[model samples]
Target chain A: MTFPADLVGLLALLGALFVLLGSLGIVKLSSYLLRLHAATKASTLGVGAILLASALHFSARDGGASLIEVLAAILLFATVPVSAQMLARAALHLHPDLAPPQPDSGSRQTVPEGAEVARPNHGNSAPADRL
Target chain B: MIAIAMFITGAAMLLAALRLLLGPTIEDRVLALDTLYVDALALLVLMGIALESRVYFETALVMAVLGFVATVAVAAYLRRGRIMP
Candidate 1:
């Protein structure tokens, strides 16, 4: 789509930021489930924003191509989440063990006189849930 | 206009791929793949606009469908050790 110099730069920058965030999530998260959440959310936002900007830019430049522009955004909205969810479900399947083990939050305990109560022992598995 | 964005987007995709390759577990790779699909789709659309051709959108749509199916199929296979499971 043809856009003025300033506007095109701005749109591109915004789009890039969105994509960057999505990519960043991959490295930052600890587990597959967490990574899936971050990756999918950021990617959707990134692509959605960029496409939206593109649609606007294109519409402003040429009136006739408006339909295509709208379609672009719609397609992004409809497809990204579904695919991401599917992938995430698959990932959990692939590595059932990858799901974060539940955290062992110690049971509530009264402090003994001059002695600290011991936290609940997490035996073998960490006590925690996933993202 | 699109050239710069495409470059950046492509770079970001590579960064995500780095995680995909190095992830400690199979699930991590799947998450990376999910992100990759999104990035690829975005690139497809941007390319369409850059080249001024609606033809790219068709490819993008096919990508959307194909990626979803593949992901779902893979997930099923992983979950139960069988496709139906």
Candidate 2:
């Protein structure tokens, strides 16, 4: 009906498209880790776009914009990555067979208990626990 | 336009449901559940826009918080073999 409305329509379409892609990815991806990569990254952007469109559409109202949608989006943004990593860790622990094999480097290094992977980017040490 | 977006979001939810049903592992099911949560929130926000109401946004916000907690708690249980660590 109006320019702003048209813009909101486009934003909604874009957001929904991203969300659909993310879902499809989870269904079609062969590996659990790959699916996590797809579901978290794409869905986060998708929901963010939708929330942005919602905020814009409600901004013209008498009470001003709705901040709830924006806050929800932020919460989604902040937590999805952590949840993904946690899920990955859990998956690895739960189904050790599902974890990908590590590249072979012919040197063994002992890792201290409770600190298998001290840091992700740490130099090559114990490749067995790199998952 | 909003109706079209709603349809698309609904389709996404369907696919997420499919994943939840047929996932090979617990982690896959959890990921699908997480995806469904976000898609549901998007639909809720769209409904708010279409209906010209702000109440749906509040509900979506609550859903977001609950979904995160569920995800984290489940992952924790899987990791430590217990819910509380």
Candidate 3:
């Protein structure tokens, strides 16, 4: 299938929006988990759109960069979630003082056996004191 | 077309940098880092095309690999304080 320039423009625009949302979400959200959700979901979509746009743009005139884009997209898709989840779990472990994420409404608010969000207070009265 | 695309992409890149600079937590910073990675990669690809240089090809590929590895490594470390525990 032949890719058109308009489609590339659309993809680039979509990618830009996705990125903007992710950054804004980082500032707007209150919790680490929510931040993870925002950044991972939004940035993934944003980068994916941009990469896809690049692929389409280049594939028409230069075929080589297209494959690199596919590779990059695959790496991005696989890595972001893994990293986000890992970081979230780690943050949960380190900063146990922070409140656990609020349970979703209408969902059975059952805590799994021994599953708890750790709340270790860093005891840092000064925010700059933390590692 | 080039100007418009570059402007949009540049705006996105700046937004991601904002997060990197001001994100409250380590995870947030990591997310910002990831965003920066993608943004930089996209910019590099565009640079390659603009310059018509295959050298950018290798550069982009190296960047892709490095970004993925770095994110994964950082994530694992954040999860457990060690990469292989």
Candidate 4:
């Protein structure tokens, strides 16, 4: 059970590159939401690749497939989206102005008219009001 | 190869830290922290490969779990002004 060192190295390198790019996006992106988009999607893929490399390297060295790495990867995949969604919603709630404007002529109206009227006032109240 | 991977991840972590420091809003800082932990997880896995040890994997696993919980809790607090209802 010998994994090729070259293959493991390549996977790790690729994963690290993806992680670097994602972090770069976090610093360079103009808005918090776009940064969130980069951080969750890119870094998850990056970490997943790194975990695969780890499993492969260790499985080869120990003569047994390492499944714990797989578990970690799965945990990461499952949790990242939930956290990202929560963060995005929190951002929207805290800063209503950050929300994108609705189109003038849309086939479907996502936000009701009354809610739209009330949204601006939300910013005026202290955030603790929602608690 | 492992060294290179570790270096890249380290750089990524540094970039995330920069965002954490310079982020204009609380949400941006939260996002940066989230990215930072994920980068740390990647680095730990890379370190495990470099050291030829399985022990680091468990640490990485714990880190991933804790990081997720922390991110979610902060986000919940920010959204509703309370973590637990």
Best by DockQ: 2
For residues A42-61, what per-residue lDDT tens digits would candidate 1 score against the true structure? 77777776666666556666
Write candidate 4's Cα lDDT for A4-43 as tens digits. Answer: 7888999999999999999999999887788889999999
Task: Sort all candidates by DockQ, best to worst.
Answer: 2, 4, 1, 3
Please give the TM-score that candidate 4 achieves against the real structure: 0.85
Give all TM-scores, in the order shown: 0.73, 0.85, 0.71, 0.85
The residue pairs found clashing in candidate 4 are none
Candidate 1 CAPRI-style tier: medium
Candidate 2 vs. truth: CA RMSD? 7.5
lDDT winner between candidates 1 and 2: 2
Candidate DockQ values, in order, are: 0.55, 0.79, 0.32, 0.74
Candidate 3 chain A weakest ten by summed lDDT: A99-108
Per-residue accuracy of model 4 over B1-85 as CA lDDT, tens digit each: 8899999999999999998999889999889998988999999889889988778888888899999999999999999989998
Number of the candidate with higher TM-score, 1 or 4: 4
TM-score of chain A of each: 0.64, 0.73, 0.70, 0.76
DockQ of 2: 0.79
Best of the two (1, 4) by DockQ: 4
What Cα-based lDDT does every candidate model obtain?
A: 0.70, 0.87, 0.70, 0.89
| Total clashing pairs for each candidate | 7, 0, 5, 0
